[model samples]
Target: MTTPAGSGSGFGSVSWWGLSPAVDLQAESPPVDPDLQADTEHGTPDLSVLLLGSTDGRHLLRTLARAALWPQRRFQFYVLENNLEAVARHMLIFSLALEDPEKMGLQEKSETFLEMWGNALLRPPVAAFVRAQADRLAHLVPEPDRLAEQLPWLNLGALKFRERDALEAVFRFWAGGEKGPEAFPMSRLWDSRLRHYLGSRYDARRGVSDWDLHMKLHDRGARVIHTREFRRWRDTGVAFELRDSSAYHVPNRTLASRSPPEPSWGAHCSARVLGGHRHGALCGLRHRSGRRKPPADQQRAASQATPLLSPETAGEITLHNVTEVFREITAWWRPRAAQGDPEQVRGDGDGSPEPAGPALESFTVHFLSLGSAQTLHHKSCYKGRFQLLYVACGMVHLLGPELGACVAPGGRLIVELAQYLVDLRQEQLQGFSTKVGELAQTAGFAPHPGAKPSETLARFYKAGDSGSGCMDLTVEPGTPPP
Candidate 1:
């Protein structure tokens, strides 16, 4: 069944296929003329189109030519490319007959040349030719502000066309003083503009121009309108490829390549989009208030508040310092195994401890538990050395040389014993007393000892054996150790 047109101006009746049967162009012509005339008088042309082409030149040219033939209205087309001079001459000659179609013989020749050029520009092998045409047309039109106001939309990079004059204004504002095709930073044009305004860059290195352009516009506060109606002519001699050619592909991969990679398990962990009553309520309130709640409020209403994690805030966590903590932990663990068995302490080929090997350089740090279990296991062996065992969540565990046999999940290092168990639960087992004595004695043997017998014993009990046994610590100050 044919869909009935929604309520709007007569423009609503115009579909991808042009005006519907109910709205005859001949019958509607007189009424539309007044509106068109009024728009023209206001210095806004009835319609102006900016055709951006590099590879799909023929397709766009033919599309514009056919569109120009619309019986009821005339559209002024501005083709932007790198070389404005050549395209200006070509278009002038091509449209000479149409400019005065009453002339004999010239009509067929003009039409034939238009078709020939269109076919050449649309073909895959003629991408260079298409690009040349685009280069020639880029500088032909003057008064961009007039075009911006006159044209309802402008096409850039790929998605056909967009109605965001602010974007074009930004481009024109930046590409100042520079002239000719040489001045245009075709590849990085979108990237630089997006980065300048939105603090984000487009990755056009992968031949993903269209998606990048859309994202760039979106990043810069542009609201894209998704229409069901087709906007451009399909199968107009241009071949559409869902995947781009390797030659046009951008090099840098991964979203992080757009900027620095986010640190592993930092404060800025990625989250899934959640929608429901709780989200709706908080977001609704925030939207109405036009301000975000304070951090204290977030902490107080942790269950309702979304995680306050972002790249900007994550930088404050000092991930670089975490590396030092990891190294300390590795040193502590290796000695413990060595003391248990000297043969096992022997260094591997890479100078790491046997079995566990050298210290881990990198590993995935899980913030939350798998399920009812709250175990955090480091999967891959770090730096081809030590295989990290499950450690307690929240608490920072340090490693040192004089360690002994202890539970896998939690065992406080002598150096940072006091700070480690400050926010943990006390254990009720004989193992705590024995382990603490051993740890304290070992600490005393070190060149610079920090742990006391009393402190070690207190921390031992506080440290849990299994990850689940560990207490859920809070990010607060002044908590007593154990």
Candidate 2:
């Protein structure tokens, strides 16, 4: 098989202890179209395998290669090493073991070797287990009932997979449909409890390197096959740490030392090390599937409109916005109710307390712009039974009988328009354009002389008012009031 040129190389200058740099053999090259014609005349192998590794990875690679159905398949190896020294060591050992059968005692030394690097595989499985347990536990709890109760503290513990079937179910779910002794070797089997334990410590923010990549590939609809039948090597080596540490650690070292020597290999290796190619591939896949990035203009508009509120400002604004509307509506209701002359009410013989007066119980605040067709609606329910309607807008007309209240932009109205409509259900209010002279004659409402009425008004009545009515003034399609 012809290997890509820059397949394996160490990341520049940074000494990562012994970890290998990531390998990317196809960085600059476009993804191979699955439909592309193959050169069958050359008699290429049936399968193409890309083996990425370093010094420690030699044993794993040899085991895999030996177990693999080769000759019928083409195997392409890419070894990435941190330094020349490590690469040389891996090459010498691998070549000797492959060429001289008598010099290879890998099977005898397998247990001790694995013990040195076992955590590399064990940690990830443990984390997956923990997460599954947490999810199961959460599913068991009754959400609504818990929410309804006013509990100061609630502790829901871990889940228990009591049956072998339960464990098998999880394994199958993750491993997918292809399952058998050959497909999944017992060596790859991990303790089921590891899932639960590791899941508990899983941090999405920190991210899972291998799983994240796997998910990215899966999301792109890539066909991934898992062979569980491979020989299991016990891990006993130093744990690989990818965060806040040198990249020359366990896995990196292993990857670097085993990469192929080719220019394309280096480029591919660089891209993989930087995570650029994978990310780009995922994005490209998403784009090809009709998922697109927002247009620049839309993005700019969104960024411009995103309200930047400081913590203190946000809190104050929220509190004040709600409280101001509440207080204003309450003020409007208090006087309006007192106008009913409560003192004149005849008390019951044993008046313990007169049944509660109809005070402002709740209110719905609507913020609207007359010039712009944007409206923000907020509903606030009060303890009392009565309801108030608060309208904050640039300009509005409260269609009332003979008494129309016009509010300028940024003004508020607290009258219950719905109640007014109910009261005037039968009344037919005449439609009249707001004339400049007539508007000036109104006591509380005045219109700008230069401003023209876009449309004639249609009137209705207020609730509980026998003769009181209201008028709805709408703008014409072509004409907008100034």
Candidate 3:
């Protein structure tokens, strides 16, 4: 379950989205949509950014929303990801996100995005839409001409053949022709996982979820998600914020962070602080073959119980869902649609209203397989190419020469903290931070000396010359470099 480290048995973590909220690069925090007209009136070069391991396109979507997605200026996002599922999921998100207002509407797009983004199951419409895109996505991979014809802005040719094929196979499964969607009982699986995750306090799963929502999530001060919405998501693996859709029980096994995990995995992802348990790396993320099932009552407990939170903490946090959080983000679609000739909608060459137009030509995302990209980064062309390098949390070991080579001199490096784990303590977070800072230093980057100790966002400037230092950082589980 070490999802961030980018290691596994050809599988993704159970969670499709990062537990931590999405972040924007400080260098481009408030992205001014190049405003091509404003640009033509003035002038601006394309905004180039390289994003490493953007879990499931949330960061990218957040960035796009900030950019206002209009002609403002050309945008190039070189998205690097190792997980094929994330790639397949990314394609789906782009499809859903780009649907014109006439077809999906702002609320529909935001709701659908959140559904497909996190839940293992989906509403009927979403499921049907996913199935419809299977053939098109499958075909789009093998034909660069079709890729260009359909998603003119998206570039997937850089991916390896095997990676592309794997992506195709993933879409085929999503098609639901071979095996029925019944194969994945997401609610049952969600309950089973909750039981396992809660360990001895399986009966207190509701209480735990509440504690995590209020005592943990709210304890951080404020969050975009409300307790009710968070509880629903935690319980069902589905978010029903602006939710007009039906039961999200359709089993989006695609979000499963991994293929069916093997039973023999005894490794722990990282240190977790369970209340009664000592601070240490936690394991047992996989279910062994022929494992006994929990009693029916216990299995039904999480489902039968209503949402709960500590009495004293009820008013401690806001009880609002993220409707407004994403409502305005989705608002970007209306203007794009209303502006004259109705937004152009291409369905990966299928004539469906999937990807938005005009902006497509200027807004391109280079889908790079992490492993393949790592190899590609070694080439001379990769030297000093990007103004910013974003390293996802728990993936610090990957900031070796290959990654370091891509940053332009004086370019910035942003390292994320493992802020997802609600129960993780300050010392544990600091431990993660100090380890990352040290790794960044070794990788030829240094953070500003003025960065506060407790700050989660770490901005690092490329140290010394462009090609000054290169070192391999291999951090073992539970043992970060001292």
Candidate 4:
């Protein structure tokens, strides 16, 4: 069971992809495309950004206007608001014109929200927008069977807006990494949407695309930035967090807030609120089994639901089907994995192995946030066969071996959060990685002695990999278990 020298997953020799810790320090940066540079010089900067799920057209238009840092340096914009009616409403209020519908057998456009607002007509721009709609209707040149192909004029130019049903196409555009027609970012900076916002600090560019700066201080306020891969996953099946503004039944916070002094477990899970407003850390749970059926209402509204991160598995899953998954992962999934059943090795679907379950109460799971690993290590419940899983969580202080020491003889340990946070927060990259094998070794575990170095993505620290037995679970932290 002894791992060979430079092979015990100790960030051994460096690799070309820089995936390994022992990666060549002399590795060069990814090459920038020469054509992209030429395009930048020639007026258009090959960069095209798509604003996804924009509720209104106002932000979309304003962001595009700001992103034009130079007079002629306009970036191409693709918008898909995920709501067809909202898109129509925005077009009506923004002085846009859609082709007449009589030729297409569709009913005439009804009175829009802006039209209903009597005061809106008093504004010069609003009155102009209404007048344009009347002109388009009176001067009907509607062509039959051309609604899908016809352009909707916004400010005299055709706007590239798609339907909500085109979610797949929108996601494909994001997921595509420098490939095919949607591969518009010709620059090597990063293959994701460029969020534009006005800067607050002096000397900082009036318009900025950096995520942290814009998301924190931009005039539009804090916005969450998702990786291209995360977006693709969300579009496919994952549900967005329940607290997301896009969720189906948005909870009225004033009525739903958890009474204060919060849960004792809140100490374990610390969320960083951006604007000094206290928002509880969102806990999304999904059953690895994927056997649980969704409720009748959720099933009907599934297509419109926003996606969320699935804690138990890597990809996206349902968010509304929460009542049960929470109970199952802590009570069912982890405990079953701790048992080491060969049948349970293959997840119910997808064919990939699921992480060994991290035990919590059969019903309630305490927070598994920033410093959760250390918190779990100190808790009595994590004593024997219990495992620890840190999903796309923040980078906090805790070593690998400190956690590896807690694994029982038949249990497993998986840590994606630490490596992810380091790569994302420190390296300023879209993905995550544990520094070579430093995380695993420090966690007091090693790659399975028999596994090849290429299998670094999922290094299962099997039971007995370290001779260290479970530590005394009696030493409790000052805050006793609820």
Candidate 5:
């Protein structure tokens, strides 16, 4: 499906979400995420999207960076996050985009960005950059005027004052103290947690790390994640295999999340089925709610469907990060266009200010705090407002029956299925599907007719627009949803 790294890498729109066989959903008109390309079309409708808790920067690169830019197409993204850290990280990413291209290339920036995201520890420069942004944001988050003056794209008016204050504290924590080897000292804490989590198995951490990556992640079609990085993150609390820096000892506070407390987690989770091949891959995914195991018959069915990884698997998969996989998503927008002209293009390789191109425009992103409320009755007028409502895999468990109310009649709703979640945590595949379908039905939605779902994803659309919403190309008009 991939050609190679070409000259125009990071200049198109694409995604690794595997939304469908057609690929590059953003490359089409009415892109998944709005790109900042120069527009040739005269009249185009505005795009509004709502996202929950997928902090992958896909909006900026994967979704928005696709296709020809349109001047008339104004894009508004309503980003709903559970906590302050997500907003802070989003701001940090924005800061990276706005950095001077002369000093840091897009590829370098991508590398830095991903590491800062996945890794628990960071390189010296990465740490320094986070600290600098945090120091600035710490001050601005408290003062609305200053924040608007600086980071104009962000709209936090939807957030409560206390939420904003909490976010400021999150930024201050990232900023760290005046002088100390470690400000928050998360590394030690990580080690302690690791030790406790892996009491007897602690000595075999290397093997365990390798097992987790090769078995669980690789099996789930995450070939992009390399063994070395995964193992490193497991062993030393570091995800990215960057040039070693002494600063790696410092824990990345951004990686932390304030999750709703669960009861007696880590009970057991193992992916032991792939079709009929049982790999017996032991995944750390656990039953957090303290739920009981299903009946023997159900578990047997689940096991047959849930495949695990084989410890014997060798051959380290050379990691293909998001950019490598979604080459078009690699292209990024600068925070600020150079003083001379918005059309001026930064030299693809060389730092030469070139002739006029597409006028650089900014999109507004509203960051709102998502509460634990089961229904999304945020506003009375919020009904049928968004074209696309996406629920990230990590947030899928929070899916409510009335969630579809937020999506427009003809719009699409995508929920990333947490792999093997049904097999272990909930009921087997049938039950899981039925539960979700019931919810969607209650909310005036139906399984999207156009979509051909894999083991990984589920797509739906409001009942009004069933006109072949499927992106799958293999099946003509697509198979009927079972």
Candidate 6:
């Protein structure tokens, strides 16, 4: 079960666990799409990996090279590039490490790619690093098929290029379907764009950070299976920064159009099974390919799972937002009978302001943890019975659709996002609240007219009758609890 001594070089000398048994090299193949099969013909490895990366700036090529050296070699790669010069650099790296260049068909492709985008390619020093990493990988490729078996889940970061919106959902959809962490590298890799590329100024106000993206992914279902292994790109003397005044554009057309016109054979096999109680709770998760569902057994298991929220329940629940802060929002409950005005107090002779009315008839409040905002949309948990309050701007903007789905006809979603954050550029803050309201409305909540300016708040009511109109949570202006 163990890889012999001297194997898995440059991939950290540590032993990896959970590698599946070696695949039968001579076994009969299962029926697959002819196009996919054709891609594997002519001595190429059976397993395919799609790698998408940028040409310059800091990257994971070293990490990837280390992974390529992992014992087992069944993987064949399709390198796609977001940066115009990425393909050339990756090709150079792969060429140095990979065996049988003419047979692997890399050399010809590298020449073509370099010819097409040579102007934008990496500098000589970075090119030298790729070759060095490739040299390290060359010693590790004992058998390509074994490597393939161990790398089923590699290159998930590549999907970042494809699924820019709803990153959590897209990531969940992919990770949920694929084999577990055993197939990927055991290292925490920072997203490269964080340091070099500044996103829109408007998004900066909405708490859009790369950290938020990682947190969202974690919350949705992708766990980081490894500890951080720090790596930095060697300075090539050329400045990597994208100047604000320069017109920067992503040349994605070639990469985008490369996917086969027909759905690949692997699509059906990788469809994810939504499991446990969450199956019903997160009904918003749909197949990424939109082609097929998981097998019948998975569907049955999901259907039988208990629902998280019941329709007949009449209790209060408090949940935290993405910021992990628990803000107090008051809910009033009264005995069906015997209510002598819960808000009024009898006059006291001492003239001391009558204690704000005795605790309004004993009531129970159910406080749920943060990220309930995500689940609400999945389960239609709020059947328009009462209003929902959201305090975080990130939750409203980043996850509007999920929250909107929870609102039943006649329920209102009250969101409070302060407009005057001094850190944000004035241009970014302009119409910021209005944009948030528009985003919420688009997600399913119908706009309500009573939003006030002082609170920096917006009210969106789910279309329908709650019997009691517009239930607002009375929270004083202040920071939420940690």
RMSD (Cα, Å) for all candidates, in order, is 34.4, 34.1, 12.1, 27.4, 13.7, 28.5
Candidate 6 wrong stretches, greater than 4 Å? 1-361, 378-385, 465-482
**Backbone clashes (count) for model 4:** 19
TM-score versus the correct structure, for each prediction:
0.18, 0.18, 0.70, 0.26, 0.67, 0.24
Error of 2 at 272 (Å): 30
* lDDT (CA) per prediction: 0.24, 0.24, 0.54, 0.27, 0.51, 0.28
User: For candidate 1, lDDT tens digit of each residue in 122-172?
Assistant: 222233333333332234223445533432233122111221232222223
- Where does model 1 exceed 4 Å of error? 1-127, 131-185, 200-245, 249-482
Q: Write the per-residue lDDT of candidate 3 for residues 1-482, one digit (tens) a residue.
A: 32221121212243244423444332332223343213363264465677776656656665555555233455667887656767787888787766665777655665565555545568877777777776678778778897899887689867878777767766765666455544445566556555555556657656666666566545554343356655665566554333454655577645543333432111221111111101111111010001123345643563466346331111111111223334544555444434454545445566555545334555688887657545656667556666667776645567766777787666667776665455566677779888888888887877754333434456676754423222212421112124
Error of 1 at 204 (Å): 17
Error of 4 at 68 (Å): 53
The global Cα lDDT (0 to 1) of model 3 is 0.54
lDDT, model 1? 0.24
Per-residue lDDT value at 396 in model 3: 59
Name the candidate, 1 or 6, with the larger lDDT value. 6
Cα lDDT for residue 181, model 2? Answer: 27
Q: Which has the better lDDT: candidate 2, or candidate 5?
A: 5
lDDT of 5 by residue, 434-454 (tens): 666666666666787656656
Instruction: Looking at model 3, report the run of 10 residues with the lowest lDDT sum.
Output: 281-290
Best by lDDT: 3
Model 2 agreement with the true structure over 341-431: per-residue lDDT tens digits: 5663445689632432322221111111111111111112211111111221101232221222222111111211111111111122121
Please identify model 2 stretches exceeding 4 Å from their true place: 1-42, 46-55, 58-63, 66-71, 104-106, 109-482
Better of 1 and 4 by lDDT: 4
